[model samples]
Target: MNNLPVQWMAEQSQRGRHLCLILDSTAVPGIHQALLHQLTHEHYRSVYRETAVAALSVGGPFIFSIDSLNPSSLNELLEGQTRDWGWLASIENHSIAILVKHWRERLLIGKRPQQALYRFHDNRVLARALAHLPESAYPEYLGPVISACFWQGEQWATVDNPASGEYPVPDAAQWLATPAPVNQERAILLVNVGQYLLAEHSEDLARLPEALSPRAWLIAQLDLAQRWGWQTPEQLHFLVVERLRETHTPGIKNWEPRPEEHAQAHFERLRGERFPEVKTWR
Candidate 1:
């Protein structure tokens, strides 16, 4: 919360922009229901309402008035959020419908025949996009957004909305027909998978082998794990512990054809056979 500066909020309030908390329904369990219980100061609107992803309205990003979040309620929401709490950004005079349209427009990528949707609510994607996108792209990326302050790495980073407008300023559709000249597909994948690990396998992440940094270890295992049908975080954790070692280089066994058992069961079977240096290797 400290990273969300009080002065910035005050300034935005003085300028008549509504302070909003952008929380993803997919990130917080029962978020839509929770909003029902905490609407004293304001309400919530799903970004999927009028967009191409409308079918996923129940599981998309929501923009809610900041007044709705309080100590106990916020803590409850954070319990489900894990490492990443959704951040704060202010909108100008735009209505919720307009803002939702703006966000929904962003979810569209690829060409006419090959449309794909990435999680715009993903903070890592937001951080990477806002940071790496070109200057002209800012207006395209953040239409009617006056200010955005969100966590970036170990500290806070703020994006200046140079094209803040009172009216709906962008037809993101215009830019979405073709891909961005700069493709961030790889960045999106890494951010999303890293986010998944942070959410579901923090213990494994903390115990990562010193021989490889967390990101490097993730890169090393990502493809193999996917190929081996190890998609769950628990399965990924098994890979992390088994393949990534603390003191020595990874000595992961290259098993042919994934076994038809749980990751732990597979590891236990290997271990029962007096697997070489399981402990010493990791």
Candidate 2:
């Protein structure tokens, strides 16, 4: 079912930039081992290295320099025999290290969804980004990537970089502090992350009132947190705990903390004051 444009990929390989395959290790579990022998350029790296979500980034997204790929290896990727792969991109004159740094800074979207994992390496995200970003942003969005070959709407497609530049990677710390240039596509991706959390923690969802849909509730809570600037992992955990344990704690849905205080501290103080009932973690 994989409509990989083989001929187009071959053409893209020789365009003076290295053609690399970006694989989602979460999707294709042992991607590195699977392509070990066929790796001509061996300059492979996970896009999450040295970032805030490093612990959670295990089996994240991997990018492998693929100036040349063996025929069977290409077949393995396209046969759908394995989990879905990422994208085939032609990157400018930069090594895998350079590319990882380029994508890593973008691992989060807005400032309020602090340190939320961003799968920027995903082809779907790339496709959305192409449509979501302004023409002036193409260079920065496609930084160092000359072109990307991936599945579009219903078939194979390629998105050539509309503009080109060194388009240097930004400092991760600074990027984390500043709101990333707003992109509707990225906002959608962050909400999708919230949905993933809802599904992953479905076991704990039963504690929530039957009238409430955990998915809908969590999205609403995320909006609340964003508005409150309660965006750190600790803050997200505080809100998730409140939802799972007791659906309603004072202002848990929409409380803005003081600028001098953190969400977890505020929630702890509220829990102590209210002394509400709770369920076992199990």
Candidate 3:
């Protein structure tokens, strides 16, 4: 059994993201059944609903659901036929984003988790996962606010304050709102890069340079387009990559050795360390 997709979905769920894939019943006959068999054999808790949908939980904080859309539901919600695989992936990605947004909102409002597994020490992991999703995957209504909350963190709530200019809250929000095209492969790269950025362990940190190289290349592309006044579909991708890269490592163009040290130190600090007080805030 090729476990790549299942493993990928599991990793995403661990980061508090859920994925739901809807496949055409006629075109992909028995595919869902085979997946169900694999998921069950692997001991993932599977629940089948009456509506031809199945939810799988891998004993994780989040649930990944796969829905084989019935003719009526597919016709009503997705306009009858799935034209592009990227579009289908985008729909599932948007659903995950919405779920993360609601979950984070609940955490911020002091809502205690009813289950032990649901409480995460760092809610930013979940936010980062949502932020890493391609801007194309976000729904028109929930994308902007959610991206603002995720990337800018506390600064998003302070948008009205003049001091909030230090953070790119407005830029992130605008970037999310803009429509763009993103393929599944590029989205996967973004997710991997996000994981490297948020990773707390040394081994994970070691992979940062390679993980972010694609992002650096993308940034260069966007920079060129903007400088030449060339219209491009990759603007949102550029903004997201640049914003995240800068937030983690400032004043560094492209991925290089110097920024790796800064990024490692930043992650180490975030991992909770003690250093002598250097200055007074007054």
Best by lDDT: 2
Runs of candidate 2 with Cα error greater than 4 angstroms are: 1-4, 30-32, 36-42, 81-84, 111-113, 168-237, 243-282
Lowest summed lDDT window (length 10), candidate 1:
173-182
Candidate 1 lDDT over 1-282, as tens digits, reads 452455666677788887777776655666656775677523678776676556556665778876435534554543343534566678865455566677765665554323346666656566767766776667666776778766555665677778864344354533333243223554454554565455444666777656657788677676776666565544554555555443245344544344477655555555444355455332
Tell me model 1's lDDT, rounded to 2 decimals.
0.60
* lDDT of the candidates, in the order given: 0.60, 0.62, 0.32
A best-first ranking of the candidates according to their lDDT comes to 2, 1, 3
Question: What is candidate 2's lDDT per residue for 210-278, written digit by digit as tens?
Answer: 887766677677777776666666566666655555544343443446667766566655555444574
Candidate 3 is scored at a TM of: 0.19
Give the winner by lDDT: 2 or 3.
Answer: 2
Error of 3 at 54 (Å): 19
Clashes of 2: 0
Q: What is the lDDT of residue 192 in candidate 2?
A: 48
Candidate 3: lDDT over CA atoms?
0.32
Off by over 4 Å in 1: 1-3, 30-32, 40-42, 67-85, 111-114, 166-282
Estimate TM-scores for all models: 0.55, 0.61, 0.19
Q: Count the backbone clashes (under 3 Å) in each candidate.
A: 0, 0, 0
Predicted structure with the largest TM-score when compared to the true one: 2
